[model samples]
Target: MRSKVSIQKLTMSYYLKDRVVTALNGIDLEIADGEFLVVVGLSGCGKTTLLNILAGFIKPTGGEILLDGKPIAQAGLMNRGVVFQEYALFPWRTALQNVEFGLEMKGVDRKNRREIALKYLDLVHLTNFTNIYPHHLSGGMKQRVAVARAYAYEPEFMLMDEPFGALDAQTRESLQALTVEVWQKTRKTIFYVTHNIGEAVYLADRIIVLAGQPGRIYKEIRVDLPRPRDSFDPRYVELERETTRAVRQG
Candidate 1:
């Protein structure tokens, strides 16, 4: 796989009152095209911050980011789609309309937007709920809508910040499966940040662990297990244990 995004000496810091806080320090990494890469670490380890920078939600204080070898100089959502843990859907819009929001912003015509939105809603198995608003859906269903909305844009990179973190175990697992389904279908590059080591191991092609207060890559673990992996399977368990150990000991 070719390198889809590159980060060199990435650093970030900000002032809160009289103190300067460092979020990331001297970070260096590369994300492959069509790869599912997950970042894991303890809280305040800058996992979310890194994802935010990648999503162009924040400007790094130092270093540079390159997308397809070109410097990313501004915050924009052209080819990047983000799924937040909060299920950041429009409360006023129906499921189909929320999915169509991005396309609308991109100036896609109403007719084509509806067609594309419905297709993605079906992909997430929410076609039947397309007419309902966010308040009418369950947490898992709302998240499925968010996932569908993210995929509707056909983004080059899908940036997720603990997207399933807020759901229950069963729902989280279901959405995890749904996420893999979407990724398999679209083959989009995914950069996800999560504190759940199990989720990271289960979903990632490669896992990057960040350590220390000013976060930096401590270890990189690759998952070689077959897809539709069983958590109880020997190889899967081994990798998950290894990843968990890395997090605890990092």
Candidate 2:
């Protein structure tokens, strides 16, 4: 697998009040093309910061991120799609319309974008709810729409920041499965940040734990288990325990 996204000696800092605060320091990582990479850590671990940099929402104070050997900043917003913990869907738009928003921004024709949007909504198993508004949908349904929206434009990378954090246990698990299904089908390189160890173990090809007080990668673990992982399986349980211990130690 070739490296699709590379973080080289990355650093970020800022001032709060009268003192300087470093959010990240000396970080280096490489994400392979179509790899599902999850970042786990405690609060203030710069996980969101790192994702923000990749999304081009913020520039790192030092170092750089490379996408396909080119500066990630140059990749443009169209190449990197982000899904937030909050289902940032438009209240005014129906599920299909929300999914079409990105394509519309990209100048895709109305009829083509609508067809594309419906296809992705169907991909998320929301074919029957395409005309529903966000406020009318359940939390999980809204999130499904958000995911569909992000993928509709066919971005090379998907940056997810705790997208399932707000859902209940059952909903979260279902969304996790849905996410894996989407990843397997689309093969999009994904960077998912979450505090849930089980979620990380279930979804990641690899996991990186970040430590705080100037966050940096503390440990990297690869999940060798087969797909559609069973949480009750002994190996799965042990791996989850191991990842939890790593996060605690971090």
Give each model's whole-structure lDDT: 0.91, 0.94
Top TM-score model:
2
Tens digits of per-residue lDDT, candidate 1, 99-184, equal: 99999988999999999999999999997999999999999999999988888888888999999999999999999988988899
Give a tens-digit lDDT track for model 2, residues 1-250: 6689999999999877899889999999999999999999999999999999899998999998899889988888899889999998989999999999999999999999989999999999999999998999999999999999999999999999999999999999999999999999999999999999999999999999999979999999999999999999998998899899988998
Instruction: Return the TM-score for candidate 1, rounded to 2 decimals.
Output: 0.97
Candidate 1 positional error at 154, Å:
1.3
Task: Kindly give the stretch of ten consecutive residues in candidate 1 with the minimal lDDT sum.
Answer: 69-78
Please identify model 2 stretches exceeding 4 Å from their true place.
Answer: none
Pairs of residues clashing in candidate 1: none
lDDT of 2: 0.94
